[model samples]
Target: MFLGSGSFISTTKAPSKEVAKPAVTAKRLMFLDSSITDSSVEVLQLPSPASLRKCALYAVFDGKVYWLRGIKPNINPVSLFVGNSIVNEDHFLATFKFDVIFIFTSLLFLKHDKFISVPQRIYELYRSGVVDSEECSVLESGMLALWNHNVDKVQDRLEYLCQKIKSDGSKDPLLKPNIDSFRAMLEHKVQSLEKAVQKSNLMMGSYCRASETSCHNHVRKNYIDFREGKLRLFCWSVISQMLNPEARSHLVPAKCDFNDISSHLQSTSSTAPLITSGNKGAKQRKITVAKGTPSILGFFKRT
Candidate 1:
């Protein structure tokens, strides 16, 4: 069922630059019977090309040639001339002509993702029932946020959109499935944040305990070395007065009657052997020497 389709050669040239710009174009035709058909043809121009860039559209139906001539301007709109054959072929040929405006132009520079105005344009188109274009924007936005790990913003936007869709109540069935997928992605991000918090807490607790144990062990080792003569001190007398109460009382408290801390130390250390007094006429006495290091008593004084 061939109604009409045609091709035309467009030629352009600059007077100063002398650059030749040429492109081919196609036009679609619809018949009155509500059926669609395609009948494409390529038209070769003469050897002498024009100096100005031009695009043409030609359609042939029932042995008639329709000429629709158009020109290009810099960045604004351009005027065009349409022959009478196209106008007489179909009653709604004005609408058909509007649809073919982009067919004659260069579409190579058009990009869906890079265009800054594309989001707004797609939103407008979506309101006019062009939903597929809107879907592209949603997919692109979601992928970018996911790649950058912008969890909060993405989750908020997705939830808001999903709730809005739900409130609309089954108007567009195509969007229902997308809401479910968005919810799943939101849940995944929330769970990941929770796990991250738990891991951080566990690591902090382990570090604190390890640091405390290391400090205790360092202090204990230093005291043991000082008591065992393994480490020479800068001032052994000051340290001995701090640790040994008997030594402290002799040096710092001459009149105070202090308890003998060495006897307490001997009573605590099980490694020391006991010695009994040889005199039977006096009271029996037991004296012991500590085999290991004494406890830390630098802050205390014997009563």
Candidate 2:
């Protein structure tokens, strides 16, 4: 077969056993760019192959080599390439941005089609009390931050979600398996999303930590006491909602009451704004000051 400087072997490292078959040449195979054509197109050469059976299908794009390995037996081939130079931080971050956009677009579409009630699923779950308090709070805060386009709050909520999921799984026996399964699913989605974007050096830090913890638990569970009081997760309840006698035990009084100090300050200085208790624990005061007095709120450290 006629060929150019692109006729090369597979980059995959095959076994040492020599297969009694003619070596597959680059011409026999085809590089099909699904986005461009229904049939194969002329593309760059493959890598140097070590053997035939172990030879993997690969493609060179830009300056890097993409190694395509078939995971499942025969049904369909799924590429499991992760880390390395393919999926980097920028790639997954772009993916996260795209996901955020896609979510909003879908919500908009639903809104346009009179499917607005569907978005209230979280609220329904919240009302039913099926969702835990902390989870509901996180979701509510996250959605509010998202609506306000507050990226920092959104990131904080996402980080908290990761921590909560890990903490819940480790502390609760029934939830451990489910959490492990959920984390595994996330890892798959993360890799697939990264691959779709065609970026390398992707970091699996979020889910990897959870997976490592799971593995560590699996090893340690057999050796250590599971019912140790120190290992139990502290009950999560709204600090303001600690009025119930049963739940009051979990509430630990702070070393010094910020409310008391604020009250004292307000009484001492008439110019100082009145500190009013708001919904939840956040406190905000509007104080009249000489034009641009550098925010009175900055004068007092938020406790």
Candidate 3:
């Protein structure tokens, strides 16, 4: 029969004289099946909160409960507590207390349709109660930005091909093959980039957002420490599309021998509008002065 949450089990068999007494206090608990053997009550001390923040979950289990730890992901076995008999049933019922159980439950509840069993080895760190909502939001946004960047790159390449087709008309026989090759390369690149972005998104989405410490903990647990260099790599990936030959010749490093082509293009493009506007303004001023000068000369002659 299935036991309700916090329900204790009492076997029909009476306690034997040889049976050991229960421990006065339980330092920790492990949630597993109710199989009480001499090795059932293994006491596992939890790590300090600061150290726990970096991990996923902390659990203390006997041999019976320890075996269940393998079924769940992100579970960290702490100190073991050994006792003669089970003390409290409610102690193990707190599913959120364990990182592996929490993650598995969240994934099962939130993403029930897509939930799949993950390896326990992967969840050995136990990172529950760490990540906050804001960090999750940031991670989601980062994933979206990466995905959008990939989409934009693909669209730009498609637009370039359209423009090329329009300009060439039916002239060059090699144009179609070149366009096809370019399209295939772009599709391949987009697929690879999308896969990377999706993996990050899944991790971010799986993160629980309850408190700042929790969020920070989750970030610390699931992700590598935030490095400026990693963010720079992301930025570079977004702008990498502009480097394609079809999008802009000058931006394409492969097409040009010089490394400073993009810088030159930026300098020239930025100055062109200013120079044109200045020339036009000067010509207008010259015309206005010329028109007034004739009147001034006539007045001088009359005087």
Candidate 4:
């Protein structure tokens, strides 16, 4: 989310500013997502606290506010004021420890969301009466995976939104990190996520059944039905495509959603001793193999 103009937000309308008359109030608008484009850059006529709440991450460029909404329900804000190159995820953590950044000495703001994230959804699940407290505890990781994804990758996504708002003088590529650094950072984070994915599964079975994935009734009620299952968890090749759109090779997951518990199951079985079809003929048969499943499945069973 890039706040294109660098002017302070005013409650009253500024004739010089472009004010958007959103049909819905800013409070209703959730998700400052990866889908940012020049068109989606909006300046609300009257943005309330709730509209500002839509952004999980924010950047101030030139003087206007820009932002990106993340899937996580609770997020502490990290403000990127002018005169910063990049805040590496590692640096974001260390700042809190050492207080090396001068801005930390002063007040910046952040908050928690009561709606529109995994924790909030599970809260509704218990309220829905479809699942018990115990069941909600083992809720699918796909949504959780969305929240737990690498913070740096989310930060890098900020660069594109910033591009949409830059003036001619601000068009320097160095305003963000070089593309190679972006590529390397994305690649490293991706491998780390995949290794974690290979080891994580907390759903009841080997794969999620869409019926059992989320509290469907709760989801439909919240969505304007546009974005319920549409969020990408963390298949990095998708980010890779975003970074280098012209690249010929595609690295997308075939059936994987980066969540081991995705409803689409991976094919892991082989023909079991090829059954006889006719005389001197044999045919292949498919069988489920539960052996390669993550050991954490046992913990769910014990529950």
Candidate 1: deviation at residue 255, Å? 69
Residue 210 in model 4: lDDT: 21
TM-scores for every candidate against the unseen true structure: 0.15, 0.18, 0.16, 0.24
Candidate 1 C-alpha lDDT tens digits along 1-303: 224444443222224664443433324342221122334443323110010012223333332223232222222222323454423221111101111111101110122222222223223433445444423343333223232342234324433433223323432211211334433433344355345434554322101111111235445121110122111111222222222232233233232222444444344433322321223343423335344322223212210
Alpha carbon lDDT at 287, candidate 3: 15
TM-score of 1: 0.15
Clashes of 3: 26
- RMSD (Cα, Å) of model 3: 29.5
RMSD values, in order shown: 38.9, 26.4, 29.5, 22.6
Residue-level lDDT of model 3, residues 48-149, one tens digit each, is 221221221222333111211111112321222336653443233222122122122222222222212222111322323345533333333322332234
Clash numbers, per candidate:
3, 11, 26, 8
Model 1 sits at a Cα RMSD from the real structure of 38.9
Off by over 4 Å in 4: 1-18, 23-25, 29-184, 196-244, 247-303
Error of 2 at 150 (Å): 6.6
Residue lDDT tens for model 2, 1-303: 111122333222443877543232322323223332223222222211221111233333322233332122122222223446332121110000112221222222222322222225224434456545433444443333343453333333333322223333232111111223323433444446445423443222111111111225345221111211111111111121212221122222333232244343334433212232223344443435445333212221211
lDDT of each: 0.28, 0.27, 0.28, 0.28
How far off is residue 159 in model 4, in Å?
A: 15
Tell me the spans in candidate 2 whose CA falls farther than 4 Å from its real position: 1-98, 105-125, 150-303
Q: Which residue pairs of candidate 4 clash?
A: 1-66, 1-67, 2-66, 3-65, 3-66, 6-63, 6-64, 32-69
| Candidate 3 Cα misplacement greater than 4 A, ranges | 1-173, 176-188, 200-303
